[model samples]
Target: MSTAVDTGGASDLTLRKEAVTASADNAPTAPEPAVGATRKEPPPEKPSDTRRRSWVVASFWIIVLFLGLPIWWHTTSIYRANLPLDRMLEWSDGKACRPVFPLRISLDPGSLQDQEAENLLRLTQHALDDLNDFPAHHLRLQLAQKEAKQGSDVALTIRLTPGESVHTATSSLHPHLPILDVSYPPNSIPTPMSSSSGLATYIAAQLRSNFAEEQNIINYLLESSTAHQEQRSKSVSQDVAQTLSKRVTRSLKYARTYHLTFSLFTNGPSPSSWDIESAIDQYMRPVLDMLAPIHNFTLDTQVQLYAAPGVQSQVLSKEDLSAFINAAEWPLSPSIGGAPTVNFVVYIGNQTIGTEAAETSQSWLIPQWGSVYLLAPPSSVHVASDTLKQPILTFTSHLLSLLGTPQSGSLPLRLSTLTRVRSADLLLRASSSLGSLARLSLALKSISIPSSVADGVAKSMHHLELACASLGNPESLEHAQIAEAEAERAFFEKSMVGQLYFPDEHKIAVYLPLLGPVGVPLVMGLLNELKAWRNRRRQKAKAA
Candidate 1:
């Protein structure tokens, strides 16, 4: 009975299995089990196609390397014009020029025999040489056969006259001329055989005294310059240097011409008219004429009635003095020319200086700019020339300082010294400019140097050479002027400075976006190709 039950159960199980299998098979045949679409095998690449692809990539790389790279390099490269940097540095260091002042002094031995005159000149020269510590400034003595000519190259003329007193000598400088009148005792005149004499020593001492300030100024300039370090004299003390520094700071730059603007500024409407033209003609004309050789002056006078002072206080302090000129309201605009403008302002006010020091005078020099005079309100509406006399004279004195004239010595001597100082000043300025340009070029490697800059440098160097060669002469002034102008032009080149603003980072920022996307594929393709080529070579070697 149990076997029959087990057989029945097995039959039922088989039936159930058959039913499940049939149900699955008959389910619409499942659309042949939905056979996946056969994937087609890719065709093998032809060697020629592979070679063509490689050639295309290689051509692209070649174009980039040979054409695109060169174009980019050429476009982006900084144009650096060839410059004589070494020569410029040499000039700045004073290795190129040595300045020497050969001052010629003429001797008029009136009433003395030629032999005695020559003897006196010889002894005087020897004494001068002995007394002179600076070798660059030399005084050469020559006998003036004629009446001392005016405005000659001779620095000074010594006119010797016989005096009744024995062993006594007196010297006086001619007010209008560069003549030194020396009255000597007959006994003081040196004999032909005399090696030395008291008169000679006295004359030498006097000349030294007369030129002491000039020597100090020259030494100061040399010391101030980068070049001529060894040529600087030890006689310039700290006090003198300080004074010179102040003076130099106050003095205007050297120029071929200067415009003189005399403005009469008044708080009230009264005294609107002034005799400025007459005052300038009478008081300032002589000085201007004297300065004609060194610089030209253009004068223009104006009267402003409603003008106001910068400081309203009646008592102007030292600080207030600097702001006294209402620069914004005043029509003191610089002249429209290469020449600088010097302003002479005569303000009609009753203001007094707070300090009683000499520096706090009613009229004060504004250093390089010009001068200002605080005048009391005029008694009349029309200012007279006499009323403007004091102010005009003050302006004249300030003008000399503005022109960088030496403080000491007579007018003629001061002017002579001014020439030398200006020459040295211009030379030093040019050299300094050259040095600055060279250093700038070195510092900014990517700055584009235009051909104009190179041309200007060349011109400057040429003019500097000429100036150096003709130092201590009037021709040097012209040469130095040209040199300074050229140097300044080169230094301030617009192109060179403009390039400085577009630095490497700026170029990168402008080019990165375009170059990055384009460069990546090219570089990666080349690298992959190179790697594949190396692997192929290795595989071929192994097969071999």
Candidate 2:
């Protein structure tokens, strides 16, 4: 019994001990507080530091506004000089210039007295005015006094004389001068107080006939210009307009001088030399001398050997003729001057034109450039002047067309017409150029206008004003030429086009790296300062 009780008590003590140990292991316990340990919080910002950060951001913004932006703008902005845009447009519209040609025809009564000559002049003037439909081109007849100079401002001088046949009048244009020689019957001459006579009517009709083509051409020019619609003449037919258009396109641009280059191109080196100088003097000098008043010509002759044509075919077609001039291989550069070069090529080749058209000629005129003559191979090493006669004549005719001379008229008359035509052309060209410049200025908002362009425009406008005032006179040609040159220079200013290639992306690429890093710090500082100020205000409100 004693042993059983002892065993049971020992078991009970062991169970109690195990249970207490387990309970102690599984039960939660409070952790002991550590010495010198506290919750972590951000350090309080100093007012000075805060103010410094605020000032840093403020200074950055100020620099951006006052210094950085201004520098950027100054570097990138285009310098546009002020221009008279309104005045330019106005000049282009042709409201500023009205062209009028008042031709003065002097009547020379060789054997008649002063009173008879005066009556004849008055009657001729009345008849001419009545016959003239175009007021722009009208003839004013004046009796030539005994002391009058030979070549005055008179467009034509009508010399009256007694003809063998009564009631018969013969009119002839002077080959060299601008004089019209008229032979009239003694009885046909208008006496004092005579209202009308056959001689007077005949002179008026003949004058009208001679100037009819000139009138048409002038009317065409005015019609083609930017003049008012009412100012345009309706007398030109569609066929005539088409013909005139071709002529205008085929003609060279007006210039004070033309470089005439006579080149003798040979396939082989045998016929290397040519008597081009003598040939030009014989055949072309007369016309050139007459054209001296309108344009000056400079002559240059060269011989090129072993010069190959552009095409290899023996028989050239009409289309092949254009490529005949080997511009790459040939040293046919323009003369070193302001004058345009007119190349007269006498290509020595056996190549024949294959065209079946009978109207086709061996020589052809290349509009605005020059004429090309395909000649047979010369028998000798040196080409004679006689052999070049045809070519020189052909060149002379082509030169007239190149000068924008009228097709139908004597050399003197054609040259006279050319002066007036050239003046009108230049005036219209200058006006058109001004219009283009104005439009370009308005179209390209970013294009820079240089001071040179402004100056050129001003000079062009000044010359244009002078040209308008003297539209019908020879002085107008000089003024119009200057105006055209100035206008062209202003329109094609090189500096205006340089900035077009600089894109905004290129500017951004250059500036973004520096601006990006600097801007981020500034913006973040400003944002943080605002947040801190808001937090302080909220805390103060809570405490209150």
Candidate 3:
């Protein structure tokens, strides 16, 4: 039966039925045919034409898989610029280099025969080798060719000048050069056959003692570089290592320039300013000029008035020392530039130091920055430039401690030790930075690594290699400083760490309208075809 609603008014409506009359033996069946309508049942439906629709749906997926997926991957994937991960890991692994400072000491025996000098050098070398427990830092003695007069023939030349004293060894450093004067007695030169000469043994022992600190510092750095499976050899025992690490920690990281800010802080307004410029020029300029080789220092001075310490009592307790500077109100902003800031503050206050309760004056080192000297100048008087004498001198001493100068040594020895310590400090700092970067890159798998960061790492590694090779030399400090700075730049790269957050709702909003209509038809067509195919498969199985 068919029912039709025809707007065109040409459709035919038809109904078909069969009538039956009762007969006792066999009922007669009658068919009421086309009196007013007709019956039409054409045929069972031909297999559906759904395969064409299915082909269209499959085509959409093929296009999406082959074309769309790749585009999305390219757009969303993080850009991981190629880093020399293996080499970087190798450097971190301590496998690429064994970090040895084989400082070559050239012997320049002005008038001695070559054979005699060679014999002495061999014997001294033998004695040094036997006495040396630290092989990483050693003095290799070699014959200096006269042509190296202009350049560094050796790290330090040990001149074997004949002296009038008894079998005694007197060592002296050349003020302007790296030469070490070793005066031996007139008759103590070793014969060619002797294995142990008194002079050779004496020289070896002296040289070893001279370089003991340098070796210890280098050893400390090597031990602390990276957390590897194997422990780095201990040239220094645990106690000495801990002490050296503390000293090095107090030292500022290597920098090309260090800004030295000297401030005069007064509790009241009486002594507002001092003649720091002239005083610095007189007392500190020469030293700064000399340090010009290793680090550039910029000097600035300020006078802060009406300041109060965190502890208002006349006596400052040990706990009150940290808060004494009044950092919140102080105008001690680091200088705007590339260099690190070293702040030296002269705190002019009536506050007495707890350590020196009897005397109401003292100062303290701020460790790696500068020192704070508390000076309560004469009451009812203004502090003139000359009044700052004691305070300035105190600041100078504290400045030495802040700048990583050793406790027990001459000024020259302290400065030299500062260089070696700074070098080691920077080396360890760089290594630690590299380890951090490796960990960060590993942790944030989605973050991008720019090529500039890779380049900086490579550059850092290069300088680190050079620094390690030239450890204990002036150039080692330069290289280590560069390496540490570069590593810091690479680790905290501004562009790399900026948070680029994109909300999920925003991504959904972006793609929903475009995907919705297309996806609906695709999904519906696939479902319809699947239902039809399943029905056909069921029919075929029943027939089988």
lDDT (CA) per prediction:
0.86, 0.84, 0.74
Quote model 3's TM-score: 0.78
Backbone clash pairs for candidate 2 read none
> Cα RMSD (Å) per model?
6.2, 6.0, 10.0
| TM-scores of the models, in the order given | 0.88, 0.82, 0.78
Local accuracy of candidate 1 as per-residue lDDT tens digits, 1-544: 3553457888999999999999998887335544787878899667788788789899998999999999989987878999999988888888878777788888898988889888999999999999988866888888996754644577888888988778679998887777888988878877788889999999999898888888888898888785786886575889988998898898888888888889999999899799988998999899889889889888788889889888999888888988888888998857758678999999998887767564445887887788999999978898999999999999999999888888876798788788878887888889989988998888888887899999999999999889887766778888998999999999999877777677778878988999999999999998988887787789789999
Ranking by lDDT: 1, 2, 3
lDDT of 2 by residue, 1-544 (tens): 3553457888999999999999999999999889999888899888898788778878878988999889989997888899998899887887777666777788888988888888888888889888988756758888776796955356777888888878589988887788888988878877686889788899999999998888788788878774544465565888888888899899998889888889999999879799988998899998888788778989888898999999888778889988888889999957658779999999998877776764445788899899999899989999999999999999988988888889875777767777777877888889889988988889878889999999999999999889877765677789999999999999888887676687677878988997899889878887887898899889889999
Best by TM-score: 1
* Winner by lDDT: 1
Q: What does the lDDT come to for candidate 3? A: 0.74
lDDT of 3 by residue, 1-544 (tens): 9997665433222211112222333665688586878577877555554566667778988888889889989987777777766666666666755555667777878678889899999999999999887756667998878776724325667777878798586877676555677888877888888878998999898888777776676666766665432433454688887887787667775667788888877777777557778777766776676666667777777877887777788788777888887778888958658778888877776777776445544777766777777777655445665666766777667656556666643455556667777776777677778877887787676678888899999999999999988876778888988889888999888777873354456769998998899889878877887897898899899999
lDDT-better candidate, 1 vs 3: 1
